[model samples]
Target: MKYKTFQTIILISSIFLSIGGCVTSKPSAENNTNYTISPPVSNNKMVHVNGTKIVDGNGNHIKLKAVLLEGWLMWNGTLWGAGLTSETKITQRLEKMAGKEQTELFRTAIYDHFITEKDIEMIAEIGLNTVRVPFNHTILEDKNPLEDYSARGWKYLDNLMTWCERYNIYVVLDFHSLPGGQGAFVSDPEFINVWHSEEHQQRTVDIWKAIANRYKDRQIVAGYDLINEPDAPTGKNLVDLQKRIISEIRKVDKLHMIILEGGNFSSDFSMYDSPLDGNQVYGFHTYNFFTDETDVKNLEKLSELAKKQNVPLWNGEFGAHKLSWIEDQLELYENPKFPINGWTFWPWKRVSENSNRYRNLAKIIPGDDWKEVAKGISDLFGPSNKITPEFTKKAMDSFIEAVKAENIVYDTEVKDLLKKY
Candidate 1:
């Protein structure tokens, strides 16, 4: 629970590396022949929930082997080497270090290069059928309600959805960051507790409702993941908020599956009494620290809950461990008695400069006094206080190149394990 600074850095890195590494290898000709790559099924159909299984419109079962796209729309300080702790801080510091125009340029460069068409092709090639795209609420909504928030965020998401459609990969849109921070980390920047504030809770519901309405008919979107690893200090409050969000979503889109995560970082489900809807999936998250027996026992509890509610159980997030640890957890997930519907690995990529490949995919900008910045001398996230426009341009170039290059390291063992089931 208490992660040292270095360990936290390593864990964030490993989370991305472990998942991203799985898709890095180029599929051999024989391997490609093993799996038939087909055009996406007609967009007229939607994925729905059956008893303990996710099935397509035709009733064919779908086991969603997925990977999470982290640190793209959402910023994690440790993962990106910014040391600012939140996306808001990261953006603010970027603006301070470089003017608004230059900041936009930097962001565009990183976002454009971070994930490309090739990545989606590789994911589909590996036999995984779904991806969970984690995004910050701010991307689609500005602080000022009157301003148009959908334009900027939609551009990127639209691109991703198009790519997913091309590859027949279902996407689970995850609202990782809420209006007010839901948890205590960079991913959930609103630290004031979203559940306690009526305004924040409404904002959360409104944003989800808007998203549901927009993508309701798009089959490429697997579902609306209501939230990601929400840490509601009060369990009842979390349940109430989720109920409200689900109610609002159903008002518009009843076709797509709705994913509801458990409280306490998605590891506890004691508050849940029944499935919110027939097409709902209960979400849970696990880490690599648990013992194998403990993992099996906990998953069995989830299975029991799924059976009791007559819905499916999804490991919405898990990873950041050795290949052996990942194999053990995957085995537990594949166990028939537990009957887990599916799981999404924590991250798809991180910058791996050391032996421990669990760090951020984006490397730190070199020639900068990042150590002092990490220690909190100043909030600037670039090279230095005396940073010139020329230096900024060069640094941004090198940083972008490093990110694109570092994001492609492969872990053959993890890939092999995932390809099995």
Candidate 2:
């Protein structure tokens, strides 16, 4: 079934407990000094790798409970109510249907309102010290030869980094979608498979090198996520490509930590025979349908792998289940014996009313035919259909309004859960 279709009936009842408490304590200088020296200092300190732990500038072990900033730079049709297969297609279609000027206006509005300074401040208030910003590779370099790099794309990222700095939150830059597409999903929009194309691989490396050079000194940038959910059927191919990217990144900046994900949508790690490089963390994605036993076993295996390689393990993406499931996952992650270094929830926000599993903290009205339009280019899978220009305009207008209003429906329960960690 299509992802949209499956989302409707995937709900399972969950019993949630009201977990609440508050502590009032007087601060003593002696206690403050002892706590301050511990890992994860409250101050805005640069984060780096220290053996198997991610530590702050003060050498305190830091655990990043972060939220993934999705559907912003990297547009997901299911989340954004834009029926396009990829971000490039969305922009091109919008420009064609609404003219360049109008398209630019809509794009600007989306970027400005999607996750603003207020959102970052709220994330900080929730006790999340980091955010994973996912972006399409095209944002950096739209051209093939990598000659004309776009400064406009960098502006959005720069804005986010600035906000992160202000909120004392570390940012993890994720190259979510790559040129020529790394996987078969619509999000990975390209004619050829990236793993098979040497040109695409080189361009990917060049993009990371560029990013490293740009944000190497930014303390708010915690690390570089080489790629998001790479589907490498041939595990060796993905492993080799990641190593090359790491080598390229190291050439420019060695201060920030590098995050390397496993093959097959970040679920398999058998390909990793040894540590790829120093100051690197192994990333894996898990969505085990809230099965506690399975989730625990999966995490245990990954943690064992991390131990074997003497590297830290991070759940780069998770969530899309009941709040109870989220709570259970967090509990497993915080296990003392098989402790997970950190985790970033799958998404910070999205619009949906049927089920809460994959819904974001906020919901918006998608124009009438949103479901039909979201079916994607019909020629490939279903009947061909186009969203009328009038409909597009109305949708964009309403979305822009929602963006500006920024009246998000806060998930206080989830927020409280995160803050406790």
Q: Per-residue lDDT of 89-206 in model 1, one digit per residue for the tens? A: 7666666655667767777676787767777887888788999998888878764333344686787888999999999999999988887656555333444446445566778888
- Candidate 2: clashing pairs of residues: 39-60, 39-61
lDDT of each: 0.68, 0.69
| Residue runs of model 1 more than 4 Å from their true location after superposition | 1-44, 82-84, 143-149, 187-191, 289-294, 353-392, 405-407
Give lDDT for model 2.
Answer: 0.69
Top TM-score prediction, candidate number = 2
75 Cα displacement, candidate 1 (Å): 1.5
Q: Best lDDT goes to which candidate?
A: 2
lDDT of 2 by residue, 1-421 (tens): 0132333222110000001000221221121111111122234355776667888777789898788887788777546655425566666666555566676677667877888898898788878899999887867875423224377688889998998989899999998887766665633444555665667777888899999999888988888989787766467777777877777777777678788887645877888887777677887887754343337777878888888777888889877667778778888878877746889886777666444655354465555554444443222453233656666567677766655425656667766777777
